[model samples]
Target: MSETTPQNPVFPHPAATLILLRDGPDGLEVLVMERHAGLRFAPGATVFPGGRLEAADHHPLWRAHWPEGEPPADLAHRVAALRECVEECGLLPTCAPLSSAVLADLRRGLAAGEGFAAALARVGVAPALDRMTVLARWITPEMLPRRFDTLFFLVMAPRGQEPVCDGGEAVGVLWATPRRLLAEEESGRRRLVFATRMTLLRLAGCADMAAALACAAVPGQGLPAPILPRLVETAAGPVFRIPAGCGFLPLETSAQTVRLG
Candidate 1:
């Protein structure tokens, strides 16, 4: 480990990511954004839309927005996922129809320090939190300088809404099948963080959006213990490995090849 690296693991900050899915002519496609190369975390990597959770996401005001029934325990995570989705990419999943103009305004309000709930009220739309389903949870490896306890949520992309990168934190956005993304990584055309690569591997199994959602809905599917990779020295060099029976396919790779932020 570098001398500057902390001897003890830093507390992981709460974070959430949204895997926006859709059925394209080619197959099941996911919306991915390229992080700005200057970012302190996961620079230039291709990843699903997401970010750290904000206090506003946990505000009690959101209870009014739920379509029915009690909000899930992870309501804040879901809200943060949707909030980051809109902040990073110009897409909003809402219970009612939302217009491009309203979305643009909401983005502006967010930029100007408007809370997500207030932004929703400003536009008279409620986030379709129910549409999102848990996919996985990953806590960054303890060896990393920055850490996040990130919950990955899967949701179908809203109809008639397209993603536009914010051009700040995110520089570009595109839709591609999971296999195609992995292929790009293989061909050296793109960079995917280890967690993203693993998540895509799971998504690659599904043939379409319906299949993907069905897999997420399976009983006890995504509620497994949080996956925390460990760094160990190997003959080749340092490597990261996830424990067995973590629900993800076994993953062990050179630490140099993996980027966790």
Candidate 2:
């Protein structure tokens, strides 16, 4: 469905995405992929690896795979994030190191319709869910026909593993510092949706992964409030306005320039 199409509002599907980060020679770098231009949602926009949650993500079997602590309210979101990361980018965050050959085989299995949990079981590994940190939560504006309540998770990229775009949902993948990405967007070399642009702006404040994680884990800093942008008509044109003090500066943008899927 077209995001701009006005229809009866529906509950936003729960979704999760991973923001893979690492310390590059220049500084902090994040992994992003270009969605296939033919896709129904967020077509051709640069985005983190993610998708709507699946039934498998919430299966009780997952209880054996996560950590020991009281499971977070968003534990299933983290599971979905890791699963999507593997499906879209060919990277797995496991509790133990996996050989490149094993990773490739798992990717092939997933492509051939293997369930994520089953694949993990075959490999005798569990997802390193403890490594993930909540970054942000956003709900698609109600004006859109298709909407998602998506959680953004941050984690350091697992060492000894490389990312490969699946060439279907994700057509290309790259690692670049947030500043570089923002610069590319400014030059029109890349297309970033409103949430992605704002996310990058937030990440741009950190010099490296450690700082970013520390910022996310500050004491008593609870999960961020869900941000639901509003579409407003100004004399200039339509613009999307997010609430103030959401950590993203200059909270308004021309609607024509923002991709809402």
Candidate 3:
């Protein structure tokens, strides 16, 4: 009999995510949207506003929007984050007085495969590269059928802009304190992906927006190398092992076990 060999898992696509934050009545709150149930990736999971980077994101027109002193190496991530934020939440950093009709048209055009820069040009809005800060990078575990090497960016929402879901990729949206959401997840009332859960845990320690931003500013501490978790099979089932001292929240054990929900 011939022996069978196992195949390698599919590689994750490079993607960028933006975590919009603001002060809530209780404490610092982060925006989250529920993925459409029919979507292929992370269906029905709650996630921050973000998506994979598109080639159009690197259009030359975006260069004019780059912030002073910002390195060029990861400009695409910043652009993609901002674009996705606007598309997913109907919020843009640009203060260029756009009519609601114009904004809706831009979103529709962007969603229909139009380049983000071109859409912005049509609406006369400049990208707000300065508003976003790189928070962390996470690579989806190899054990999963789908994966994404995603960059997470943190930014305070533009003043007077309310975040609303597009009703397509995302069906609903809400803002809640990290502590409150984490507790709800623990009680099984809510579902959170591992990365989102860990992020909330870190933010939960912050007393306010300033404290959170201060914590995020610490180099290598807040933005560490891409976190690639390993999968370990156990009697209970598959559990992901997050290594300790990896610059993210330290695992309780030398390696922390997590269910891939």
Candidate 4:
């Protein structure tokens, strides 16, 4: 192991990521955003919309707006996923009707430090937490300075809801099949972090939105333990090894060698 590699890993902060899906002309498409080049982590790489869970997300006020009966342990993560989806992509999945004006107002409220529940109240909407399908869990390797235990959620894009990148945290957006994204990155036209690469590999198994949703909903599919890669030294270089049979296809190659920002 390298000198910098930790002998004992630090606890990872809890985080969530959203995978927005839609049926495009070709097939099932996933929404991806390019992080700002200046970002401290995952700079200039494509990622799903998500961030760390905050204490504010656990406030009981949010439960009044989140009717989906997700386990309490998962409630904060799901809420955080929804909040990030709206902030980063301008796509809000809610029970109440949402207009451009309402969305604008919600954005303004969010900027003013109003929480998700309060923002939803301004628009007379409740978060459709059921829309989100828990997908997978991944924990950053301990060697990294910053680590996160991230929950991945997948949801179908609401009809007529156009995704607009805010040009801040996210600089650009693309709605493409997982296979296409992998190919583009391999061809050197785009960049992907390790988590994103694994996510795309899993999503590539589905042919369309229905298939994707069905696959995600399959019983016990999302219950595998969080992926924690182990650094292994090799003659070529240091390589991270993810365990085999952890729900997704086994990665035969070292994940550390994968292109990451």
Candidate 5:
């Protein structure tokens, strides 16, 4: 951790993304939440399941459950990610809510308030981390006062499951397609952050839910250098573009595969 890494008064907290996917009655769709807009940072923006790392996220009990290979350097990041997903979308991919007896035991340990880590252990429920795959990472520009180093994860929800919003932070929760969302962005119907736009473009290339989830799981092990900004002139006005080639490909569906051109 560098001096620049977010600390106590961290201006830019580490964040995570939960891309919820399911084969809905209409077709394949992704879960999205609309922000309340009263607070700072991404206010009123439509986003995926995600939020900042909370202190409870780093409990030692949960640490024991890490999947094989190397554990993430920041466990808080992971806990925040999973917690945010549940809090925001209620699309938890676990074995439903635990039975009453199991829930009691876990809640007691969790009452110790060990945070997401130790509590996860005490509860005896190891989150199926294997089901989650890192899809992309994004850092808000330094120019912004509120910044974040965010990791996006993709998880497939089983059939018949629906995403429910907590109704606090988010005003609307719905399943939408990338292409449809993009069109919404073009019209006055919706708004998207840069990262959301990028992710949607990548998904647009995927034929269906299964294919999209499969593509999301393809892993790469390099930490990308932070992207720099550039100026681009569009007919509407001026649009900025950032360089691609992170762990995941930056894709745009043009007449070709994407509009990365």
Candidate 6:
């Protein structure tokens, strides 16, 4: 038997998402990654930076370096967040890189196709998982062929670090206003998963990056994996409905099927 979720093993993989934010010409904007074609999941989609946790990400030395408080057994999820950020965009939050050597080494590793996990191991600088605030948890419903226990995290763009699209995995990366991005998605200029759209809508309601980051800083009340169901619509395409008591706003659109909490 697989050693996934003993409690609910059917949904095996655990992942993470990064809600990168910064000030833009217009106003506060969020960094979105345009997923590459080679990805097994969400290919060609505009998504938050993230991926599935890897076994190498859980190295004892790496986990030990995370910020205070015992790391949840889910440290890999945090690693995935960092890895995805680095892979999709050339941004990383390293301490004032001691010298040019630090950056040189980082570039070399990245050039050699070494993801964040590898670069981190080479530099002995483990990810600061404590910096991540789990904003929400989502579980792919059984109806979907693929499922994930994904934890969403929010982080501010670190000083001296600017986000750039990798050209390989991500075609374009931009700090966009939530509403503008929504309009673009609606116009079919951008592609997004139902979850990403809902998350953006919720983030759109927040006043500032500080407030948005604050939500994850405290890891909202608590998260129960949202299991969204798919339902066909008459005028709209397909959409999912949230349970009566779920705090999430209900969405009834034909474009995407989603159930959020």
Q: RMSD, each candidate, Å?
A: 3.1, 3.4, 4.6, 2.8, 6.9, 5.7
Cα lDDT of all candidates, in order? 0.86, 0.86, 0.75, 0.80, 0.63, 0.67
Off by over 4 Å in 3: 1-7, 95-102, 217-224, 233-239, 250-261
Candidate 2 global CA lDDT score: 0.86
TM-score of 1: 0.91
Model 4 C-alpha RMSD vs. true structure (Å) is 2.8
Which digits, one per residue and each the tens of the lDDT, describe model 3 over residues 1-261? Answer: 121222696888888998888888898998998888898777777888999988877777666786565445567888888888878888776645556666778888888988888788887777677666777788877767778888888877666667779999889889999998888877877777788877888899988887777766334323357777765555555455566755567443122434343
lDDT of 5 by residue, 11-112 (tens): 556778888776655556788889887857677778887888765566665556666766665455556777776556554555444444554454444335
Worst 10 residues of 4 by lDDT: 215-224
Which ten residues in a row are the worst by lDDT in model 1? 216-225
> What TM-score number comes out for model 2?
0.92
Candidates ranked by lDDT:
1, 2, 4, 3, 6, 5
Clashing pairs in 3: none
How many residue pairs in model 3 have overlapping backbones? 0
How far does residue 22 in candidate 5 sit from its true spot (Å)?
1.5
For residues 1-261, could you state the per-residue lDDT of candidate 1 as single tens digits? 312234778899999999999999889999999999999998999999999988888999887777778777778888999999999999988887888999999999998998888888888877898889887789988777789999998998999898999999999999999999999999999999989999898889989999888776343423446888888766777778787866577467777877675
- Candidate 2 structure quality by residue, lDDT tens digits, 116-192: 88888787767898789988888898887788999898999999999999999999999999999999989999989
TM-score order, best first, reads 2, 1, 4, 3, 6, 5
The alpha-carbon root-mean-square deviation between model 5 and the true structure, to one decimal in Å, is: 6.9
The residue ranges of model 4 lying beyond 4 angstroms of the native Cα positions read: 1-5, 68-72, 217-224, 234-238, 259-261
Residue 174, model 2: lDDT of: 93
